[model samples]
Target: MDRFARIDTLINNARIFISRPSNRDTEGDVTAVLGVNIAGHITQLAAAHDRGGR
Candidate 1:
């Protein structure tokens, strides 16, 4: 935001998912999915909030 002078919008479409149960791993799958879907969104939202974003 500082570099751009203003931030109008923030769009995050990044995600992770396993279609088949057989392809899923115990630790790694849960970690990746939660990291991307939950933790990642929280981090980005925090950043936007700090920058006075809407």
Candidate 2:
């Protein structure tokens, strides 16, 4: 904040879809879903701050 001192725009398009309980626990499913759905967004948001936002 002190560096750039402002922000203009921010976008987080991470998403996940699980229609069944079995699908949620399958191999690679949890990592894929959580990685794209949550981890990715958190990473991008953190980058925004470090890079002066946008």
Candidate 3:
């Protein structure tokens, strides 16, 4: 912010996929993916919006 003065654009490209098969995936693994792939992006977007990013 100090260097750029203001945020103009936000490009979200973060994701998480379970490497193993669904049958082999544990509850913790599924939870972690959901937390990062969904909640994490939402949190980031909220932050960017607060900073005036488009």
Candidate 4:
């Protein structure tokens, strides 16, 4: 789907996520969550911008 593609693009594109592997995540839970949140913001902004700032 386009949404999945957008996510891939977001992850692959220039981005800065505060995700860090931790014990709970067996890696970085906080970092992962932060990155996801940031990505969501980015995606929403992109969508809004594309809609003529609507």
TM-score of 1: 0.47
Per-candidate TM-score against the hidden true structure: 0.47, 0.46, 0.46, 0.40
The sequence of per-residue lDDT tens digits that candidate 4 reaches over residues 1-54 is: 345533234332545444544554634556766776666676676676555673
C-alpha lDDT values of all predictions: 0.72, 0.71, 0.74, 0.54
Flag the better candidate by TM-score, 2 or 3: 3
Better of 1 and 3 by lDDT: 3
RMSD in angstroms between candidate 4 and the native structure over all alpha carbons: 9.7
TM-score of 2: 0.46
lDDT of 3 by residue, 17-52 (tens): 877779998889988888778876665765766767
Off by over 4 Å in 4: 1-27
Order of candidates by lDDT, top first? 3, 1, 2, 4
After superposition, the stretches of candidate 3 with alpha carbons farther than 4 Å from their true spots are 1-13, 40-54
Q: Judging by lDDT, tell me the better candidate of 2 and 4.
A: 2
* Cα lDDT for residue 14, candidate 4: 47
Which candidate should be chosen as best, given lDDT against the real structure?
3
Candidate ranking under TM-score, highest first, comes to 1, 3, 2, 4
Clashes of each: 0, 1, 0, 9
